[model samples]
Target chain A: MTAARAQEPVIVVDGVSKFYGDVLGVSDVSLRLGRGVTGLVGPNGSGKTTLMNLLAGLIRPDEGRITVLGLSPDQPERLMRRLGYCTQVDAFPAGSTGRGFVVHWLVASGVAPRQARRLADRAIARVGLLDDADRRIAGYSKGMRQRIKLAQAIAHEPDVLILDEPLGGLDPLARAEVIGVFRDLAADGCTLLVSSHILHEVDLVADTVVLMNEGYVVAEGSVRSVRAELTTHPLQVLVRCSHAGRVASQLVARDDVVELRMHADRGGFVVSSRDADRLHLDLERIMLEQGATVETIVPADEDIQAIYDYLVSGAGGS
Target chain B: MSDGRGPLLPAPSLRLRLAQAAAIARLELRHVLLSRRAASVSLLAALPLVPWVLAAIYGTPGRASLGEDLVGFSHFVDGAVLRLFLLLGCMLAFAGLVRREIENRTLHYAFLIPVRREVTMAGRWAASAAAVATIFSSSTVLALALACLPHGRPAVTAHFLHGPGLAQAAGFVAVIVLATATWGAVFLALGLLARRPVGWGLLVFVLELLRPMLPLALKRLTISWWLTGFLPLRSQVKAVVGIPAPPPSPLAAAIVLGAVLAVAALVVAWRVRRLELAYSGG
Candidate 1:
């Protein structure tokens, strides 16, 4: 496929710092983006939502500059029209049918009356809520309510979409469907910024990742690049054999095996080394030389979850 | 090229601002029109006027002095209905305008939109004004129609559009509209600025009620003081009450009310422009 359009930055933040009284909301955060999907990942209270609000023009940073679609968050009118923000707090006006509510929202956004209705229908259909479009919002389930919120956000076809915890309350099936919608929207070239504590979801949907912790952007880049920045620890080895005691002694004697734990179930012996491949080779030779039956050899750091934990907690670096 | 002046243009126009305002208004209307709470409030508002109608029908028509007294009673009843309905309408409408959004957590939903905060505030005030008028008008008409029976006074229907009464009632309606709109605006700012608005709104109500009893010019500082000054009954009771009289001209009173509204609107806009959602230690 031809390269997707590379326009000027639709959003830019420079040295943006926010504080609530004395507590830092997010400090000295800077980012520039034009399009495509970017995942904002962090534990709760890590300021992912705050940064989303800042981008949506819902809130202003006290100490820095932010421009969304070349409009200041402080001046929400011009910017709001060009962006669609699906807030974590999903709500609809009481007593209104999903169809009526969505259409009215588009009308309020300055869509022509007739066009508003059409667009509302189209958006509801897009979110797979076409069958239930005419039902009162009060009668809808939580997952359906979230879809209505999504429908309103996209009804006007805003240039940018900011979704904060969009998948928080969905069931597994609903999550898969919503994730498909997000991926499709991103693939269509909408500048999508999603914040979720669910790491696997972010890894699946985002090409770029911004990791925050304690009101700071600790890491931001391509997912692979940022994960690689983690301090690589020695690989772990677990061995279960007839001569386990002898294997443990041999592993500890090696300079690379820094930490060792021996299980009492006779299941195996666990050992950590700086070079996992080297340890694998050494263990192979030792097992052959000692004639010990080996059961399992696994590198503990091979999973993304482990990499995420290591990056977030500064486990090795700090 | 043209005397060093650029083409004369309306500065950026209020198109976007107006659009934002309309969206907010539409949201409020959708909320009030569709919600059960609004229906319940409408029922509660009409409930008080029911007793008056029953009293007018079944109470003592055979007494000698009853005819004259009934005539006088009719006028008094109409005026009281107008006054009471407007006052209650304002209190109830503004209370809901500020309180319900917070309770539902829907106010934060609006903030997520790219609309200007001030536009949202003002639009809510506008929508609430429209909704309150619809509720109060129905009550006033019902009360007036009941009051017009037996006296052959042609009822309260035609009277609404007549000579001095029309201008006076219009003025009354205008004051009610402005007072409630201003009240909603101020409370909306409080709602957006603070985590809790109902507590603050009630405190403001108490402050306004005690304003006239204060020792200084602080009476002018209260919204109720200006609102009551515009009440036709205040002019009637001025001599006997011995209250510190407001300026003599009704026009001056109107201007002061207008000023209060303008200032409150500006404050709401300013507060909304700077609003920062700061729940998580930010």
Candidate 2:
């Protein structure tokens, strides 16, 4: 999926903006998403679901153009075959069984009933819901309902899968099961765009992250690559030394160490700086000269949470 | 693949699309059958039986055979049932066909189907009409039979199956079917056009009740005018409701009703083609 994602863009949104009368939905959004699981990470009302809805053809953008798989969403009869969208809204027609919900979507999408039944069984099994597949959806637990929604979305084996909050309401066991299914789909070179508010959920599987805040993409790229490019944001680092206050005082005068705070136990220091290499060299010199025992030095901003905080706060949001 | 073109799935033929629509309708009909509103419709359809039951139990009791009462009551069911309760039942049956799904946020199941939106609407329309006709027609048959119950079993059996009573029962059944078809189409369109179609349904209901008092030109606009035309003219109804001109022939009345139904279908198709799955405001 990583090799394929670099080839070409499958979905193109060119300067698209949507508005609901006096309220702004999403404004001046553009993206060229390719293959693999590109996670859309944002806070509530940050336009994550709105962008997903736009690409899924649930609502039309008031401005600009959107093309999914080279076809406009306005032509759903054609585009829907290549794309499947699993919404966050957990709803099904009343009195429908789990198998019936999955099979109904397949048969209504022009698959023969015989094949639909087989695919429904395959999908239910893929989600590890084979045992409860025959139970009515009304009787399903929250995790089971989430699996059924995933089953229906993937039953037809579409090329582009857009899931909004796909991991929500899942227990640890079911979450592991569905994550394995997503990995398998990606292994087959399928394109997936998943959205979730759980940052760790995105960090677990997504190689590329689209960080959004207040209706705009603040940053998008591989998590590590995005972190590397945040040169302006002070990189938070932890220094575990015997004399944390003395080390912090000696290193605080350097140009690279913008701010420093002694650890609560006085055994370490937490420093914020714009440079990594120079800060590490200065810390080593201070520790060696002052006879301080340096246990460990860790760059805390090398992970997804740091990248997310930098970009979201960089977009003028806390 | 490098040119950004995704694999285009094979398009389904028209024949396959129709089959898909039938499958969707079959799935949707089961839930609709158990909806709270469908129960309300059934209760309303059977409401027409009430006044007649009281009349048979308490009105002018004598040596008069209830077979005579059944025959008389069966004759009046077409005008009364079609004019009042069946229309309301059919309206309830179809008003929630698509609108309720949108409100409940389950409409997305239909939106992503690999067929035109109109096919789905047509399939649901077919199912709703079938259910409404079946429910209301059974109510009419049962109410008419109640009228024949006072007579002995021989008289009741003879009147219903072996004589003109069968013909009368069939006549009322046909009127119920037509009313469901006409008003079902009307209410389904209103469901698509307005957020609160029941509010609009009140206006249509008022127009239907006032049909007899309006001029002939204004009367023709109401579905009840064409529906009542299918009945054999009753002098009592005509004297009170003032049927100034003779009703159209059964064939002419059907043709007019069919035309109205066609327009409703057209509006449904046109509206569905542009339909986006945006839920209404809270």
Candidate 3:
């Protein structure tokens, strides 16, 4: 790696494709992930979980190779030693307490019995499940089960962490706490790859994003850079003002504005702009000069769904 | 690339690998024991003993023919019913040993831990074998004691030591253990190689069942062919099937079982190395 790229990518997928027979798990997918929290945002069955499985060595890609921290995906004994994966699946082996589940996994990882218990305790405490550590996992609530899974993954403090839809089961408070845990791990220089269906959740903690649709990575980079490439797609901004009619007339006069649509029953109008930043400044100028009283201005179409739609529009075609 | 975490777990070694496998066996033992998967077979194992216990305790008219009853019980029930019962029971437990975890979506946790896949497979096999043997072996001993106890303690003692009685009992135990171990390896390998092992189980059953009908040269291939030689009393049913040439000597029978064990170990070791965890793959 060049000095400019000093922190080498921890995971690399080179022209990889996985197929369950004819159905594509992922097609010619390639990615390079560095040391930080990276979010994988995609709709259901868009190959997010499939890609995680490939990295975790739970499945092999039929076509191309995968490397995790300079180790092959086939080498679980080596790859898993430096990595921890938290899956969305909540089913644990029956008849095990939270403590047993975490500690036994640590023991299986070659930690001595006494130390495994101590580490399991710390990990459980970190996820705030210490009180319920003695209870069977099957009896845990959905959010509690989510925390315990996180607890097991972080117990060993592996350098590379992969989580698949980990936050879907959490309440707002637990979600915030788990996100805090991710931040702390990343702050400690751990590489985190987190997948989620919600865009804003990824937007919260991810330093970069890998967006996918229909088994292909639609876009990947810093959220700002990825959003910048959607230049041709109409950026919809919701403008709420007292005199919507007057504001729309002035906003349309600008070259950046593509079109305008009025809200059904409000003092607001949706402005389609080629450049949202220029349109924002122009809207302000138009509002001040027109003496319009505006309630709120929000970017309505800047989320992941809009980006995915623009990139993979014809993917479902036969 | 370091995360600046504390010291890592021990480096992989044979000692640690076996230690990890033993720990996994300990963890899995409780779970397998409490599962309902073995319920039907367990009930079947104990059911045959219930009649003998009732007969032994009460003054049943069949008590006068105690020696014949014991022999019949040893050959027919021990060799046939309980042997098949352990085969099916152990098959159920060991076949799904790895696959059930994959099916339940819990197998990834084993893979997620920094351990060799072989360790987990060995641990699961050990734990399943331990649980199956505990339940089935007890039933075997109970059924034999029930038949022999009412014949009078002194007579039973004399009968057990002097005659083939002791060797016969030992053989039954040996057969149960070897059969469970051998088939456990087979089905565990099948479980690892494919998603649904029921089809493989059926194929093995047909092949073993046809072992007798084939010529003597082919007979050596069946596990039962070697195992049947160790029985203390000759099997009446085998007389009809034809002993072919006289059954191989006891040492040869054991050597054949050892070969089966070695083959089983190789299959398990080979399959687990490439065993990928995918629920849909099964």
DockQ of each: 0.21, 0.32, 0.37
Steric overlap count per candidate: 3, 0, 1
Candidate models: Cα lDDT each: 0.67, 0.78, 0.78
Cα displacement (angstroms), candidate 1, residue B151, comes to 1.5
Assess candidate 1 and give its lDDT.
0.67
- Give the range where candidate 2 chain A is weakest over 10 consecutive residues by summed lDDT: A309-318
Candidate 3 CA-lDDT value: 0.78
Over A1-318, each residue of candidate 3 has an lDDT whose tens digit, in order, gives 354444788899998888888888898999999888999988787889899999998888988889988888788777787888988886898788999999889987888889999999999999999999999988999999989999998888888889988898799999999999999988876789999876677778899889877688889988767767787776889989988888898888878888899989758989999887788888898899899898989887666556656665653311
Q: How accurate is candidate 2 locally (lDDT)?
A: 0.78
Clash pairs detected, candidate 3: B195-B282
What interface-residue Cα RMSD does candidate 2 give after superposition? Answer: 4.0
Off by over 4 Å in 2: A1-6, A236-299, A314-318, B1-10, B51-75, B144-171, B229-240, B276-282
lDDT of residue A61 for candidate 1:
80
TM-score for each candidate, following the candidate numbering: 0.75, 0.85, 0.84
lDDT of 1 at B17: 67
